[model samples]
Target: MKQDIHPDFKKVVFLDTSTGFKFLSGSTQGSDETIEWEDGNTYPLLKVEISSDSHPFYTGKQKLADAGGRIDKFKKKYNLD
Candidate 1:
């Protein structure tokens, strides 16, 4: 590995703002904020809009919207009994 060629990979805390969910992981991303984790360690805090905890797919609360009317058309074409 080349020295100083890679961004700093360190432990960081990712915060899901919507769900108030937080997790710790290693990343090259840096943050100006800090948070005390459950392990009693301080890590760089990175705030994000969504994560697996709040995401539709992971949470199984996905809303399948038929914006273009294609899905509805397809279902109509098949003719459900």
Candidate 2:
């Protein structure tokens, strides 16, 4: 409720390079670059390496973390048959 003490929240675009996706949202995040949006206004453009679209969980392409058949190695070591 105070004036000049809060950050200006405005609509900005987040660009995901991995998936070439652009999203418009509001935030107080800072950026050094500006971009012209669809509304004929300029806002800070934030570039991110990953987002929901490119993430493994969202795309259902997650890779198992096991290295060199760790599950089989463990079973063999313990003689679990």
Candidate 3:
């Protein structure tokens, strides 16, 4: 453990832009804007493009690729059976 050589780990709020969800966590990053979190304290707000809530894996809403149909395209180009 060293003194005065570590980043300033502070509380930050992550705002999911797509779902409008907010979660509080700690980070070393700083922000110009502050928000009143559910804990009734003002913290730096950071906007994120995607999170598990809106992500395809956890939600099982992933976009399915046309595997069978696209196989022909790949075979024709590569000249494979």
Candidate 4:
């Protein structure tokens, strides 16, 4: 509960660089850029490389490794089958 020692936390717009998705949220991060949101207000604009919209895991596009094959190979090599 100290005064004048904390960074300013305010509403900022995060833009996904890859998918061009934008969302408004509170953050302590500062930016030199600005953007007009859907609410007819301008907010600090922050660009990010990846977000939930374009992420592989979130979008169900992630490739799973073949762990079963690898395990079988290892067992065969060690003669533990």
User: What TM-score, to 2 decimals, does candidate 3 have?
Assistant: 0.70
Q: Which digits, one per residue and each the tens of the lDDT, describe model 3 over residues 1-81?
A: 879999999999998777777889899998998999887899999988677777798878963434346878988899998
Question: Which residue ranges in model 3 land beyond 4 Å of their true spot?
Answer: 63-81
Better of 3 and 4 by TM-score: 4
Best by TM-score: 1
RMSD of each: 8.3, 8.4, 8.1, 9.5
lDDT scores for all predictions?
0.86, 0.81, 0.83, 0.87
TM-score of each: 0.72, 0.61, 0.70, 0.71
Instruction: Report the lDDT tens digits of candidate 1 across residue range 35-64.
Output: 999999999999987789888989999644
Q: Which regions in candidate 4 have their CA more than 4 angstroms from the true location?
A: 62-81
Q: Residue-pair clashes per candidate, as listed? A: 0, 0, 0, 0
Model 4, 1-81: lDDT tens digits are: 879998889999999876778999999998999999999999999998788887898998863344338768988999999
Tens digits of lDDT, candidate 2, 1-81: 778998889788998766678888999997889989888888899998777877797888963444457888999999986
- Model 2, C-alpha of 64: deviation from truth (Å): 14
Candidate 1 residue spans exceeding 4 A from truth: 62-81
TM-score of 1: 0.72
TM-score-superior candidate, 1 or 3: 1
